[model samples]
Target chain A: MRSKASPVSDRSKGQAGWGLKSAAWFGVLYLNLPILFIILYGFTTDDASYSFPPPGLTTQWFAVTWARADFWEALWLSVQVAFASMLIAMVLGTFAAAAMYRFKFFGKEAVTLLILLPIALPGIVTGISLRSAFSLGDVPFSYFTIVLGHATFCIVVVYNNAIARLRRSSPALIEASMDLGADTFQTFRHVILPNLATALLAGGMLAFALSFDEIIVTTFTAGQQETLPIWMFGELSRPRQRPVTNVAAIFVMIITFVPILAAYYLTRDTDDVAGSGK
Target chain B: MTTTGAARPRSLSNSFSTFLYQRPRLVLALLLVPPLLWLGIIYLGSLFTLLAQSFFSIDDFTAQTIYEPTLATYARLFTATNLSIIFRTLAMASVVTVISGIIAFPLAYYIARFASGRMKALFYVAVMLPLWSNYLVRVYAWKLILAKEGAIHWSINSLGLGPVLDWILTLPVVEGSSLSTSYIGTTLTFVYIWLPFMVLPIQAALERVPRSLLEASSDLGARPNETFRKVIFPLAIPGIAAGSIFTFSLTLGDYIIPQLIGSSRPFIGQAVYQFQGTAGDIPMAAAFAMVPIVIMAIYLAIAKRLGAFDAL
Candidate 1:
């Protein structure tokens, strides 16, 4: 009987059995192969076409990418858009989350639902709608339009994190600050801000990463502006310097990956970030 | 209590803070209004306007939009070509969703039940890192891998399986296409890109299933297989539902993968993009966009009923 209970405790252990582990390994490998292949092909000397084992390898593609003015402009634009959208999302999403968490108001559920809708709906739906609205309003397609499109979804990411953190932190903390002579701004600046600092950071990073890699929404809203991903899309189909594009792809992988890793570390212990979902 | 505060006047910001603190409702209103207006009015307003545009028709001769409210744009949707695009997209999305679900479940189950904390975190990274990486690059990589002169065929030839590779390429639906140039490649890439969505939700659901329940079933003289069938599988359905939502919706909305990897025929996303960008037909694009919106709305409603929201 004692032995049976012990086995049950070990039921969920890593060494539980081999079949489960092998199946899980296959799943992980399948997910990663494409990414790994991109990195591998980035080093290939065959620029005209991809071959499984490269005829040769060289470091020239990276240098070629470095010398491209268009790549730099696209990268810079993506950074600006990512930062702008992250700032907007952090401010608006944090405010909404803090307000919704602290006070119960009418139509609060509706407000939350509304925030979620942009991300919840298909990107094409959000994309065309914004494009239609822009054209209808006679707003020119520009950088501002792209930021607005990215911000719609970015706000949801920040709100999810901020609201989750706010819900978990006690109301007594805020009340006590006011009780101790801290005014509203001080209470928020001290108690609320500290409580929210990591979530906000996590949220902002995730939002930045999202905005950086965003395509569908940006496609409709970007007008003639080409963010890095948009540039990658065009270049893939009509690629002149193919390996340079792969090198640019490698660059994108690095840019988006760093923020995502940072966000993951910041929020790993808490399931508050938008895509964590569980 | 400050030395300069014999009878100091409060700063404007401090006074304002005090005032705001005194009225929580007012504070909430101030905090809430900006985001609400941004999302509600700006976003939903744009959406409503889009829906309105979908009902209008475009004038071909004038190259202008006719603003009168009508169902003329939607009427264009049932044209044989448009319907084929819609059906192709629907079939691909379902195929991707089902394939991803089947692959993800056992993997998620293993991570949820069998792995240690460190191993689980590693698996989470494995699942999420690709999702965070560039979407286009992944598709491009698959395009190369499935190319006629690419890795899969190369491997097949080296292994002395030359005829088998040719046979696959010559298969009826793929006669004019290789792996990278057909609907099959599109489905495979879609599944690859969206697999994390399936894995994470299912993992979350699996983790929530209690060991005690499994133990109870087995203690009652049930076999492990019986315990799993009766208890474990049913509990994980919502997670699978939640995951399917992402895979299905993403596949439906995606234009890039289809355009990059497949042949000339357009999916809903590509058609919408082309109509709006190339043809300068916003009304038609808006109408095409509505297909996914209507499908997703219905799908989400069903998902909510299946307890998917709880998992999310």
Candidate 2:
């Protein structure tokens, strides 16, 4: 009798366990359904209107999309912008973080606040302001301007990451190095750089991801040029490019997901790195 | 822990040697100059330009700038239509923030308190994935979901509730006869897009609430609700404020969702876009951008007063 009762209770527990599992599965599916639809429709024959259960399955859109030179060109431009902006962000952000970390300068707090302002402000504000400034300076919208505009906000991400990592580091290490024979450059290269390498790489990846998907700022700064997002925006607005646009969007989703996932993994072990200032 | 007195100069030569030892600081400062100059020339200078542009007006007939200082654009911003647009934008932003806050609090609590190490990391990654995808793609995906013959409508109809769904669709509360181009659609998209911002900060705050503190409260015979209200809520207010800043400011300045989903109504973002894109009125666009700046400034000031600058 005791054994039977235990079995009955175990069966009930099993049913309840399955119930929770199904619910969780359904929730995650609902969250990702839009992305699923985009991927599914990429292989569909319906070009005029996107139907829920796509009318017919076809892969011809992929071929057409691949054949288009404009697609490749836009993708290349986006890659260039993301890379350029990431490099600028890494160098600038590392130096700024080091300066603010090491010094007791006048207006330190004020300067830090100013550095964060562009990011905290709405992207539209940054976009419009940069556009206006570019026009005033008679700097025609080009790849350089786009990279410059992106770096303004991208630096904030890298700076935040680098500064957080710097804070996690013990000042005692540097002091100990100096107390020994090592000079400043030697100590930084040996001690600080190794400590910061993971964080800097993670920050750079994150900055690149942001620059890749950024549209509002790019829109104001790109002018007639088409980066991947800008090109997708145009494709989405027009009726003829719906299928091709879906393909392009899938491409973007894949590129963005990988780096961001890597970044999350790199930073996950260092939770205190995020809120160390407190 | 060495004080400045411990490092007091034994002689002028020792002081000079110390300066040479600290030369990396100077090099770091020098390396910082280029980026600082970039910010000053590009970001800060553009804000000055935006402020100056607002003083000029657009010519009515030709849609060209008059280039003369005037308050006419400010005067027009006060008109009934524009004021209503501003109010609607604010209302939408507030609604999104509140809805996201409510949903995020429970999820964030569950993850922070219940999940183990690996599960917690996976959940965090899931939350941030949507943020990395293209903004335009996300908005467009929402558009497809809310379209007349879309999955939402199809699912509702298939569930033997077609009449009820049809009636709701025909209501005046919806801007259009369909769901695609309406305020409801726009609000939903904003909530989904900004939800991650709300979750991350709240999770960070909740994680800081030590498990021992909760156990101690329970050991003292306090109920869970009592402990949550008395202990947890106060600690998490700063995180709530930071999350609200991101959600509110992002929603207010977003023109893309409104363009894609909003039918006839124009939010401030759309208004600014139109001034630049369609009307070619840069001054009017600059004036429109000031609305969010003022609101954000007030928010930042309050945040500073709360000593929440570090929260950001």
Highest DockQ scorer: 1
Docking model 1 quality class: medium
DockQ of 1: 0.61
List ranges where model 2 is wrong by over 4 Å. A1-31, A270-278, B1-28, B61-63, B303-308
**What shift in Å separates residue A8 of candidate 2 from its native position after superposition?**
32
At residue B90, give the lDDT of candidate 2.
Answer: 89
Per-residue lDDT for A1-278 in model 2, tens only?
A: 76866654334222223533454334334345667777877887878776777788888888999999999999999999999999999998887898888778777877787789887889999999888778867998999999999999999888888998888877877777767645556687888898788889889999999999999989899878899999888888788757899899889988888888787778767746433333
Report per-candidate DockQ. 0.61, 0.35
TM-score of chain B of 1: 0.92
Give the Å shift of residue A104 in candidate 1.
2.3
lDDT of 1 at B89: 89
CA-lDDT, candidates in order: 0.86, 0.80
* lDDT per residue (tens digit) for residues A226-267 in model 1: 999998887876645678888898888888899889988887
